[model samples]
Target: MQRYPMTPAGHLALEEELKHLKTVERPRITQAIAEAREHGDLKENAEYHAAREQQGLSEARIRDIEAKLGGAQVIDVATLPKDGRVVFGVTVVIENIDTEEQQRYTIVGEDEADFKINKISINSPIARGLIGKSEGDEAKIQTPRGEVEYEIVEVIYGE
Candidate 1:
């Protein structure tokens, strides 16, 4: 498996989720399964079926998180020298050239990307276009809607 880049915070988040799944959810589901089984009639027991399904989904998520953590190369942006360039875990402010709308986004790992929180995945088109760019640089992104241009206004490293 190829190792991929992840911010230190993103890596920690995944580890925390894995820990919760293994230590809390796993045991809770096991108890639920036992209770459902004790009710008898495994084939017709709706609770038993639901509990088993939940167990499968939870286990799958746990495995996925584990694999990602194992292959993660955690990077701490704060330790890196500030060069005013866009990099992983750096929050960037950009202004849309056409609408003059400004937005702030932090480039992060795929697993940690949440558009609602303004965290974009490094592999995303916008992030890819912004990488290696410094403040005052223009970046052209190929979005699903169409091509959009943005001017870098700031590059922030620390939280």
Candidate 2:
């Protein structure tokens, strides 16, 4: 089994979503299916077909969440030593060598990556470049645009 590295927050979020799907969405979809079944002929009933399709999608999502949770290895960054090295679950501050633009990004699992919130996936180009590097180190990252150099200013854990 392939182990997925995840932060404590990401694991909890997935668990919450799974619970919501089972408790709320599953019941709602079942009710919709039941109500649709009352509308006479099943062959030509669009509502019934749509309800079934929705149930299929919801069930698939639930299974996916469960599988992810099963394979997840939650890593608590707080327990790790603060050695100033960029690693998974750490919030890293990097400054662009060219423009001097500084950005803070939290390295997280693939499922928890939200670029708008500055949570980057560990598999991402920038995060891959920053990982294992120490503070004050210059990292040259390969992005979609081209190569970019950044200075690692800080590495914070549990932030």
Would you estimate the TM-scores of all the predictions? 0.95, 0.96
Cα deviation of 62, candidate 2, in Å:
1.0
TM-score of 2: 0.96
Model 2 lDDT tens row, 1-159: 778889999999999999999999999999998998999899999999999999999999998888888899999999999999999999999999999999999999988999999999999999999999999999999988899999999999889
- Local distance difference test, each candidate: 0.94, 0.94
> Would you list the clashing residue pairs of candidate 2?
none
Could you tell me which 10 consecutive residues in candidate 1 have the lowest summed lDDT? 2-11
Residues 47-66 of candidate 1 have per-residue lDDT tens digits of: 99999999999999998998
Q: Which residues of candidate 1, in runs, are more than 4 Å off?
A: none
Give lDDT for model 2: 0.94
